[model samples]
Target chain A: MLAPLLAVLGACSQSDESITEQTKSAVTQTTTVTADGPPRLEDGSVNLGPPPGSMGFWTANNGRLVNDPNNYEAARREMNSRVNIEDAPLQPWTLALTNYRQDTFIASEPYTRCKPAGGPRQIMSPYGFEIVQMPEMERVYILTVSNAMSYRTIYMDGREHPAEILRPTYLGHSIGHWEGDTLVIDTVGFSERSWTNRDGLPTTDKLHLTERLTRSSLNDMDYTFTIDDPGAYTAPWTSGFGVEWNADQEVFEYMCQENNISPAAMVGEGRLSIIVP
Target chain B: MKKQYIQCRLITVTAVLAAFYAPYVLAHHPVSAKFDTTQSVTLTGRVTEVDWANPHTHIFMSVEDKSGAVKNWAIELESPIELEWGGWRPDTLAIGAVITVEGPLARNGTGQIWANSIIKEDGNSVFDLPDNILESQLGSRVEGPAPRWPDGHPRLGSEPGQSGYWSVPSQHSLVESGVSVAMDKHGILANIEDAASVAPFQDWARDLYVIRQQNFMKDDPLFLYCIPPGGPRMFQVPYGVQFLEQPIHQRVTVLMGGGNSNWRLIHLDGREQIGQVTGNDNNPLFFGRGLGRWEGDSFVVDSNGFNESFWFSNGGLPHTSQLHLIERFTRVDLNTLQYEVTIDDPGAYTREWKSAWTLLWVANKDLPDHYCQDNRP
Candidate 1:
């Protein structure tokens, strides 16, 4: 499998490729740490989270759940909990990835090229997103296991959004409702080439959003988000966190365009330079 | 009559926008980074060119090696609307028509073949059946009268000679109306030409299926991305499946027309396979982990985890996530259903092999919305 671990990691790292800022700050301090607690529910039904069929897997440290498989490094701190957005609120000649091309890879983020990382960069990656919950076709799907195998049906049956001449995708056009078990959603027709998350943030084609989600203890998930857009924000912003739930985590089929050498070695502006082929 | 209902609603909106700009409706790849699903090779010779098209369907052929050299290969298949709904016709491979192929090989060494089956010259394999019992030309179409359902099942469609005829609407229940070519699902319409019986691979899966078909199956993630069809290629695709049968909820819902508008949930309980009632920790599905029952009027089904990211067949043929599957369906009268499938997959293949086809009975119809990147093929 993987040729003797790439001949033992190609003989334990040949030229560490300029050490890319000490391996992304040592994989961003093992990716955001913070797992302590605050999400409780063991079938108590006292309300939220663990109740909606919780088996496991959710991040942003909402209530802790990398499900301890020898601590996959504590689910890389809720999938590297987004840090530098260079003070967002932008909208005055936008490009901002620390002020554009400031070290190449075209200021990264566009999922380094596998494309469509879309809104909240798929609720901030590490590959998790899956809500299902079909309440008899009122619809709720979601399904974002990494590069999102294109899902997010949502419609909740009340119907009322399809008009704007349709086509503007990359996970936009969602529409949910329910207020008791919480669930909100509301997305708008997006596709300004979709972006967000590691703040390589750009978005347009009027990208309005809403999200909400709720559930709190069986594993967690408080998720929030707001982000309206007068064309890439100058106002309307709010964000969110907490989504833990890991019952064993099954989305592994990363196929990120197989071995994308991320446009051949250029780790200064955003990242991706592993060349295993 | 109101201007003929606006000319039949403008011919049903011009046949639903000509099926979303139909250009062979696309997407479907994966030979594993170009071939090496445990390697493979067989080749026979002569068709020379087929193309066919729509997401995939190549052909080519030439073979000859051992030093005599003369390669030529190519192969591929599936699409041309799932090989014309399984019965195949576009002359059914004929330039010179010799055929044979086996599959895998490529990882750049290149002759080419994401193939896996094909033996024709009447030895029959594709839409097969030359043996496996052949007799009954219309006698007692299973005696007649069937339409049940108070949970007694039966009632599915097209059963004159027990629902397996096809002057045309294929997926192959039995065809031949003057070479419409079909009958392979163990119904054996062999027709004439020979050679097809391979499926025993595993030398490490024939060298990883030729390094994933010489490096172009690009690691094959659901054929480079239009993912959704779970085993028994979701009833041999020809896009027309619908069976809801809930039986109070023991579970049985299968509604796959192809990619983007999918639905598979078949848990009929007896539990030999079932998981993902709640998601997390990966249940690896592209239609595996099914589990149905009912054998008398026939329903069967089985499935397994499945997630090598696609290709149990379309000739990209690799398998590993262990790959199990049994399937069976049998409507046998009132518009036929038949099916069958086996493929045990000892990690890749060195044993188990069986395949069958047939579906018809579309009746009334209502499934449409395909999506595939809006028309990617």
Candidate 2:
């Protein structure tokens, strides 16, 4: 199934090395992007971690996520709200709260307070993250280098989310399964503690994330999700972004709580100055 | 007169003292800079109060100097956790028990001293001496040969078809092997005068360690800000740990159940440990750079490049960026894992020191989910 996508990329001139190297160079030069098929486990599932005996992690190109993928770069830099606002089904109160959050330039984000980046924000935070799949333990872990260097566990052992989550927390209950080459994850039971995106989108305990991760090539992964939060939005909506794989790098220790001073002085008003790039 | 009446009176008095005991938040500072270590003070006083808490434990005493004027003095000691590991109970120091203390005096002439040792009037110390307490057994009593992987290497992790983790080590602290110095599980010396005997510490490192002990370990980054117990401290903590050996990846993942669910990766691909960058960003790692290889049946790991933000061990053992650790994991039996680590930090120690202990295998269970944030002070 992935061979067809590899065909669309291009013919490989060199079999001496992995195709991810070629794709990385093409991405840096802003040239025609081409990718080779991703490595796989013996069971034919995508090897989320570095291919055996190698070290690497996924680095999201789009730092600020939004419903509209086209405005990712613009929103990340200038907080540009193009098609995202109109597409979102935010409730009236949530829209007002989002505006208030944006007005303050998100200085008081939970991430700034040395709290968990939570949800989509985890990938959006600076530094890279790794997806470790433990087949023997029937568990998958998403370990991040940012935001107190925390990790989230996703059960892959045919387990259901508890009927009730007694204590709501950041990075709530996650259950994942492999769908062919794509890894699908369902997350719920979040507290109303963090924004859904860097743009200050609202979230509630009702937030349910149906996320799909497809590694089309060795160097690139396509991430998409449909967020359903009836408490904060009128209807479910979808958003997505692409993450680049760093073939030479691995995730390392990052403790954000040490000497963090931003949250205490986050008093501000009005939107940040927009760059007209 | 009945002997039972005296026992009852003691129990009633102890219960009343326990009820009235309250914790005090001592302002923590560098002991090397605040106290006069060159000068010693000896005071014979009655135990007025005891506050068992995190950061540090304190015992208030009423003492009369040569001037015959009685004054209340504050004596600092190790944290409650370390004390508990040293076999101290809440009622170990009875109120009004006459005791003698020897320690360094404060520079500011305050009625405070970093208590080095506390001796009761009965000539016994408040803590159980490591000599009196029989040393931990060399290995657990389980009867079986250790399991091995298909490659014929002793497995450091769970065997196939087994659901378990390595935990509940016989020794909860990292002390220099063969050193008879009395100390708590965190390597907090029961007598500060024996600091040099515990480890081959440089002059400044020894002073800093004494200061940390005097401050009652209140300055521990893990206790104060929930910093991950980065080094050997991970093995010394209460919560259990799990090792996921992935020969295919050529790396071993150590999952910590205590340190805020943190994990450390040890590369077994024979990669060079020097001049490595973290994700294009040169960040000093908490777990340092761990490179492992199989030496016979033992898995030996060489690690270095540790930062000074966190202590490598409990009791605030000081180490600089030049810290190097050589750790060995050998499965002595089916249920016993012998762990030995050699500290080679030239920045802190005058000579290399080694500590070895064993962890028992916990079967049919998983590592407990204990996050530092839930219990951070």
Candidate 1, after superposition: displacement of residue A141 in Å? 3.0
**Per-prediction TM-score of chain B?**
0.29, 0.64
**Superposed Cα deviation of residue B9, candidate 1 (Å):** 57
Clashes of 1: 80
Q: In model 1, how large is the Cα lDDT of residue B1?
A: 9
lDDT by candidate, in order shown: 0.49, 0.66
Residue-wise C-alpha lDDT for candidate 2, range B1-377, written one tens digit per residue: 11111110111101111221112111122343344555566777777777553334667777764555566777776545446545687688988887787766655677776666788879988843342222221123446788888989988776664556776666655678997777655555668888767678899998998888877576677755667887787887655678888788888888876655678888887777762444112456688888899999999999887778887777787888888899999998888888899999898898889998888776645554444443121
Q: What is the DockQ score, from 0 to 1, of model 2?
A: 0.11
Residue-by-residue lDDT tens digits, candidate 2, A47-144: 88888867778776454445434322232444322235767888999988877875544545655545565667776555668888877667778888
- Model 2 regions more than 4 Å off: A1-36, A67-83, A258-277, B1-145, B160-163, B181-190, B279-283, B364-366, B369-377
Model 2 chain A worst lDDT run, 10 consecutive residues: A268-277
Q: In model 2, how large is the Cα lDDT of residue A170? A: 65
